[model samples]
Target: MKHNALAIALTLLLSALLGLALWWDYRRNATPHPTPGPASFPIDTRSAARPAPAPTQALPHNGLYRCDGPAGTSYQSHPCTPGSRQGDVSGGTLSTVTVPPPRPLPPPVASVETPTPKVGLIARGPRPGEGNEALCAMHERDIKRIDEAARRGQSSESQEWLREQRRWHKDEMWRLACGR
Candidate 1:
C-alpha cells in the first residue's frame, strides 16, 4: 500500500508541472499586438493644387538698332531716336545723337579701252593654207624628214625641225595664205 500511494503522489506532481508550463507559454504569446491591416502615410497637396507661373514675353520688333551709352554700349531692339536727348541713370551722362545721310553711289564709269586678242603658238601638224604649195611642200618634206629622224632615234634634229615648222605655220601666215 505505501508503494501505490507514492506512485499516485508522483503522478499528481507531474500533471501540475505540465499545467504550469502550458500556462506560461500561453501568457508569453498573448501580449496585445497591432492589427494586421493596410497602412497609410500623409501627402502634401499644395504642389498639386497650385498652377505654374507664366513665361516672360519677348522684346518688341522695330528695326536694326544700335545703342551707344555710358554703361558699355551694345546693340538692342529699340534704338533711341535721332536728336533725342536721353540721360543715363547709372552713368549720369546725357546722350548726344548724330544722324547719317544716305549718300548716292557714283555713276558707273564707262569703259573706252578695247580688249586685246590673245595669241599663242599652235601645236597641230600644219594649219590649212599655212604656206604656198612650194613652202607647204617644203614643210611637208621637213616634217617627213623629222619623222624619219625620230624613227631613227635622232631626237635633237627632230625637235629642231619641229620648232622651225611651228614657226613657219604661224596664224598670220595661215590667214594670209588662206585669204581669211
Candidate 2:
C-alpha cells in the first residue's frame, strides 16, 4: 500500500513538472499581437487631374498602291496613273509541276516454317535402371548450370520458372531412384 501511494505521488509530481515546463516554454516563445489603431495619412483625395485625349481621322480604304517612278520604284497611298505600264505587285507568277503516280507495291513473299523447341517429360519419370542413369545425370547437370547462370546474373529464364525447373529435376531424380 505504501509503495503504491509513493508511485502515484511521484507520477503526479512528474506530470505537474512537465505541464509547468511546457507552459513556461510557450510563454517565452509567444509573440503578442497589438490591436490596430487609426492610420496616419489621408487616402480619400485625388492628387493630379488629367484631361481627355483628341480623336483621330479614319482612312477611306486600307489598301497600299505600288508606283514605278524615275526616282526608282516608289509605293504610294494611291493607284498607278491611267495609260501607264504597271508591274505585278500581287505576288510574282507561279510555276506548276506534274507529279507522276506512285508505282503499285510488289506481292508479299511466302513465310518460312519455324522449328519447334524440344520439351522434356512432365510428372512421370523414366523406368529405374532402364537407361535412366544418363537422363538423371543430365537433369542434375542442367540444375547446376541454371544455378550458375543465376549466380552470375546471366540467366535467360525468369526466377520463378527456373525454380520450377529445378524442382522438376529433383523430382525426376527421386522418381528414377538415380543414386539409390
- TM-score of every candidate: 0.20, 0.26
* Candidate achieving the largest TM-score: 2
Q: Which 10 residues in a row give candidate 2 its minimum summed lDDT?
A: 52-61
Q: Count the backbone clashes (under 3 Å) in each candidate.
A: 0, 0
Q: After superposition, how far is residue 139 of candidate 1 from its true place, in Å?
A: 6.0
lDDT of 1 by residue, 18-91 (tens): 99999999998998677766685676687768854322332243333444445545544454444332222231
Q: At residue 47, give the lDDT of candidate 2.
A: 48
User: Candidate 2 on 53-154: residue-level lDDT in tens?
Assistant: 222322233344455555567545566554333343554443445799999999999999665554563335455657787888898899998787567654
Candidate 1 weakest ten by summed lDDT: 84-93
